[model samples]
Target: MVTLEQVKHQCRIDHNDEDTLLLGYVAAARDHVQRYLDRTIYDVAVPSEDPDGVLDNASIDQATLMLVGHWYAHRESVSETSMNEVPMGVTSLLAPYRHIGI
Candidate 1:
């Protein structure tokens, strides 16, 4: 997870402004999602139980699906507020994969 201090330091250099909690939160959120996808999708492991339930326990397809669902559920509110704007880059990256319905 990206720490507040790390985010603040980067933000200060990027935005040339003082560190703010909100900025740190945004950065951390993005970092968290990216890291989650990277680890879950790239690293695969066998399911301890119900092997049949998970076709490929090691792949991250399920986790990605879940994350996508969660994002879609919150898209409306996230799109509405300027302060909470989803990072454009991240949103763009996930756009093509957005399922039509939850």
Candidate 2:
């Protein structure tokens, strides 16, 4: 649900060469957050999306951006440095939205 401008701003890149890649990160991040939450973050602007979120869009947006930042920072699965779990607070932000079932 984040934009190219936001992703660029987050990654501190001012060039457009990686716009497509950045945008891809946005989508992947959205999917990642959605899957984690087991719920959809509704955007009133998107007509087909159901407005069923109990939380604000900003929470989801922030969570997605957290993921985007992580994925953007680490492009390769095999990092030169030690691996870390998903960026801090990703679960913290999305946990409230998680679907708890019987």
- Point to the candidate with the largest TM-score: 2
* Whole-model Cα lDDT of every candidate shown, in order: 0.39, 0.75
- Cα RMSD of all models vs. native, in order, equals 10.4, 3.1
Candidate 2 residue-wise lDDT, 42-71, digit = tens: 665533455444443777888888788988
Instruction: Please give the TM-score that candidate 1 achieves against the real structure.
Output: 0.24
User: Model 1's lDDT to the true fold?
Assistant: 0.39
Candidate 2: the clashing residue pairs are: none
Compared to the true structure, candidate 2 yields what TM-score?
A: 0.80
Model 2 clash tally?
0
Please give the clash total of every predicted structure, in order.
2, 0
lDDT of 1 at 40: 20
